[model samples]
Target: MATKSLASCIFCKIIKGEIPSFKLIETETSYSFLDIGPVAKGHALVIPKYHAAKLHDLPDEYFADTLSVAKKIAIAQGLENYNILQNNGRIAHQEVDHVHFHVIPKPAASDEEGLVVGWPAKKPEMSELKALHEELLEKLG
Candidate 1:
């Protein structure tokens, strides 16, 4: 498991108030703030107080507060349409090493605003999917 890197982690610095941020909500286990560079006007980020590079690395206890804060931010912003995004690594578009959830509001139906996603979905044989599902179930158990 990854340990907290308080001294070197930027998110940790923000949480400790060593770096200034446009603060939104602060909970016992999470901190939320406005995104410095927003794809949309109400884009915000919620992060767990415990430092973790990925969601799977985070302590289970930290999850509720992180998700709850994101929900609160979305509701407070009155976002009718939005995307709650969490990226696991650099290849997945995670710029910061700390685990975070982005609450990006879709204020308008424009390519210029909000997160624009491309879904290059692929269809696989049902037998292949069944085998994958069985493998995952066994691992989960």
Candidate 2:
């Protein structure tokens, strides 16, 4: 069955040509466009044509194209250091209901430019990690 698209989705509208976008590249399964509200120069977005609210909701077939397109955009722009970001839920910073990847270029050493992230690393018990790994492995099987 074909995946149903939300007509109200902004990305869907862009895909349908209803909305204008600064298109960078387009493939059979994905679309790439320059971000209008860029955090840095050469900031772009790559999205799968198949509309899904979250990454887990998307099919495996659509995965390769999205990453490939993102790679092409980064290569074409000569981005040496950059970030490929994807958010799932609203609380995780996903503003759009459609799954998309952000290709943010970190051109300079200034924190003011590009993606700035705070890594709050925590030390957990090795036993906890081992238990979680076993649970995940069993689930995978």
After superposition, the stretches of candidate 1 with alpha carbons farther than 4 Å from their true spots are: 1-3
Deviation (Å) of 21 in candidate 1: 0.5
> Residue 18's C-alpha lDDT in candidate 1?
93
Q: Which digits, one per residue and each the tens of the lDDT, describe model 1 over residues 1-141?
A: 233656889999999899999999997788899999999998999999889889999889888888889999989988899999999989899999999999999988988999999999999999999999999999999
Model 2 root-mean-square deviation: 1.3
Model 2 global lDDT (CA atoms, 0 to 1): 0.94
* Candidate 1 accuracy as TM-score: 0.95
| Deviation (Å) of 80 in candidate 2 | 0.6
lDDT of 2 by residue, 6-99 (tens): 9999999998889999999988889889999999999999999999999999999999989999999999999999999999998999999999
The alpha-carbon lDDT assigned to residue 116 of candidate 1 equals 98
